[model samples]
Target: MPKWISLDFGAKYKLSRLKLWFRGDLEYKDGNYPTDWDVYGSNDPNPDGSWDSWTFLHHFDEPYKPSGLPHKQYTQEDIDYARSGIDYEFIAIPEAYRFYRIKFNETTGNGAFIIITEMTYWGKLEE
Candidate 1:
């Protein structure tokens, strides 16, 4: 099964970028990070709204392989890099949104889960 996470920004904002950090723990190495995912944004708060109400922001289909090492055994630098987070700039998206969603389609390991340690969104509040 696929996994997803949603964030409510409370109000509409001109989203500029997003930062995502995956779990850096040494024990949970297999399939800990997302390999394929899609990002969506929505301003409609109605629960009955359809999926079409959300706008597609981006789709990442590449594997999340920060460390080139085999067996997914990462070095200290890799761990630090993961902890620092990966940035996704939304330069093409000019619209404002009140909510953001991340849908995970695949993971690095055989597991069916995606482990994200942190998520940060940068944007300017709509006036």
Candidate 2:
């Protein structure tokens, strides 16, 4: 079972990179952030919500972002990184997909909720 957050672009586009910023739990010591998750792409005109339906883009297990450690203390770099956001660029060009989705499988604190400051998709519209 996957809890997919789907996005429809209305048309195909060749994707470039993904930028994300988490600003939900920064106030807390051990804030909530995605520790492990996945990204998927799809051009299926009609998807049926099956594991085999979406295109597996990448399995993100080691995304270097930022963190507070030792005694729930955040560094200057950590603060900046969180505020500026991080980019996850595609190593190679991927096929155009009109629709994209994210399956948020897990998070760092595994708290009751997760907050995202922003989510930006970098790509060029397909002709």
Cα TM-score per model: 0.76, 0.76
RMSD of 2: 3.3
Using lDDT, give the best candidate's number.
Answer: 1
lDDT measured at residue 41 in model 2 versus the true structure, 0 to 100: 81
Model 1 Cα lDDT, one tens digit per residue, 3-109: 77677888888878778777667332666766678888887745864576778888875433466665556677667776667777765676878888778887768
- Residue-level lDDT of model 2, residues 6-117, one tens digit each, is 8888998888888887774473233345656777788883566665667877666434636635334567766677667767877665688887878777665555455677
lDDT (CA) per prediction: 0.71, 0.67
TM-score of candidate 1 on Cα atoms, chains taken together: 0.76
Clashing pairs in 1: 31-109
Mark the 10 consecutive residues where model 2 has the least summed lDDT: 24-33
What's each prediction's clash count? 1, 0
